[model samples]
Target: MEILNSKEMIYSPTENREEKLSITGRVTFLSMVAGSVLALTNFISNSALAEDVIKIGTPLALTGGLADEGKKQQIAYDMWLRRVNAAGGINVGGKKMKVKLVAYDYQTDGKRAGQLTEKLITSDKVHFLAAPFGSGHTKITAGVAERHGVPIVASTASSLSVYNQGFKNIFGTLAPNTGMTEAMMKFFKKKLPGTQKVAVLGRDDVFPRAMAKSLSKGARNRGFDVVYDELYAVGTLDHASSLSKIKSEKPDWIYLTGYTQDLILLRKQMSDLGVTAPIVTMVTGPAYKEFVDGLGKLADGVTSSSWWHHATDYKSDDVFGSTKAFYTQFVKEQGHDPDYVHASAAAALIVLQKGIEKAGTLNRAKVRDAIASLDIVTFFGPIKFSPNGMNQVRDLPIIQVQKGKVSVLHPADIKNAEMQKM
Candidate 1:
């Protein structure tokens, strides 16, 4: 804007030509001062507006083994970002600040993920962080965030060890592995009372290994005989030998834990070896549609437990309003339904958003305090962080894939069907 106006200049009637030049000199001096003030004011306004934005940085595994899961997380983050900005951004201390997401692909390397997380803090200067895909990656990155004093939310990491490290800056969305195991154990013991023998298998990675160990303990505690408990090498292309040993066990219940591809390949290999159990359970993989797409009929009668499902009849005044509302919009935009990974990813940002709003500033310490003290309900579930920073919501959903439809089979109240025998 033009700050100095020529029409506002004063003129003296008695001034001669020489005096007029002196009057012009005074006007020029005033103009310079006026211009200086105007420039200074504009600079201050621009800087304040720039500071009002919240930049959230994340290292995603957009390539290699974790690429697919990383994309699911990206979709959730993108959806939340659009909604928050569209609603005129978050109101922080009476000032509205828009959000910007800064992300880099970590290529499924834990070391690289840690390196990028440090870079996001030192170089990108992000106000917050969303951790990488699984517990293996989140653990590596969350430590870096803690040392730098940046608040990080992990959407998928549920292993107890992830948060037991005494790091205050790290928070997770999914409840601990025990919740998933306990829910499955209770439901199976009640329904399949005759179930005696159980076999377990999992990928030799952080989250999967942790889940397998927890599930095996829970099964043994529930009086089921746990046999053939083992973990395969990470990124293994073959599980034939493992499947053969499991088949030899003649177990009534077979429990497998791994990511999407690993589960799919294991299921296919199980079919090839003619290894079929009366009750087959897989952690997490059945919650995703890709598992069914990859295995087709092989996915049927596969029971699994997840931290969330869109069919949950929960509501919130937050971003998506309710589970049904989120499901409708996600299906409309992505042309497919969302899985637990998607819901958990979106919920993680919602937690971060609430922390920022409650603290009324992007100050890292303040936001971390607000998040740590939070105990609230969301569209996904009730979240109350344990003292250790992992979600304390224990109401996990147990599901089964039947004829291409993922159905809730346990917890009695929310159950849509009973377990089917193959």
Candidate 2:
């Protein structure tokens, strides 16, 4: 992943641009300041006090392989916080509380994320906790929050095991891998006809392993021949050997599941090895804009499933309205377009606000109960919690990257382009 520079702000105003104040000498300025001390002091004091405050803790992958996702999530969180504060904050038992986001970079390390979550709970004493960017990192931190009985909204964790852990304090914003892979299989069978042979490759992480298992099963159920299947460690930097094995089988399609860098390296090596055939469909490629930018022309013709795509052909305003607003603010703040990170973070914040409102109090237990019972109509659509704490909107659309832009190719409601052979 590419490293983003630290935040910067530029201010420019000439002397003549000053609106009203005109002080000729140092003594005049001092005398004028002393003359109207009461007004200035009262204004400053009241403005400071009028700012209500609520603390939020976030442990995200801000510096390592998942930095791209973390940066996007941070931008979304800040935007939501700004919007809430501008609207006079959230109503908690008839009192307003301004939201304050406190984020820590876990650098994509699970151990570091767990440690930071402990500090956030004990030292910072945040009012609420938001989950991290990566699934692996989120799992580690969820344990910490569960031990402390803190209510947490897990933003980007799509694995089913994340909810199966029986941690009542935790809730996932994204659909499970089983459901997502099912949607992908349905699209593949309808779109790619007479192509039965399939190959599945993924790193031996919780998310990829689960996805590969379910996706391979889905392919078989759809009458496709599961030619080859393999798993590697998350640290695998090269897939030449794996690709060589896959080429020997000459499967009709390749289903890759893993982190962004892992997928990029696999795609780059596949191109270099000259083993191009069948369609390569990944699970999380559309979640990051870098997936398109990194591969450039090589990304063309590659198709992947997306939970939230920017293209809006549906007549309903919910999808297009929310996506456009989110994209505009995300690009303005982070200088990039919206991705899964932005959508996940925005959904988490909306869910949190809804839960607090329903509970009528900010108590941890009350909030947890409220989250379990929430049926929210979010910017993404209706988000209802299942018995196991998963979102009811689990079906995702399959999209393809064509001509440097993403176009949906599934479920007719939003398929903008046809799927091409890779």
lDDT of candidates 1 onward, in order: 0.85, 0.75
- Off-target runs (Cα >4 Å) in candidate 1 are 1-48
For 1-422, candidate 1 gives per-residue lDDT tens digits of: 00111122111121222234445778657655655565556456645755977889899988888898998999999999999999988879888889878788888989989988888788667899999899889999999999999999999998888999999999898999888888888877778788889999988888889989998988878778998899998869999998999999999889999888899988889889999888898877888888888889999999999888777878786888888888998999999988889999999999999999989998999999999998877888888798999998576889999998899986666889878986
Candidate 1 — worst ten consecutive residues by lDDT sum? Answer: 1-10
Question: Using Cα atoms with residue i matched to residue i, what is each candidate's TM-score against the true structure?
Answer: 0.87, 0.83
Pick the TM-score winner. 1
| Shift of residue 315 alpha carbon in model 2, Å | 11
- Candidate 2 vs. true structure, TM-score: 0.83
lDDT of 2 by residue, 212-243 (tens): 88888887887789988889886887899999
Q: 387, model 1: CA deviation in Å?
A: 0.6
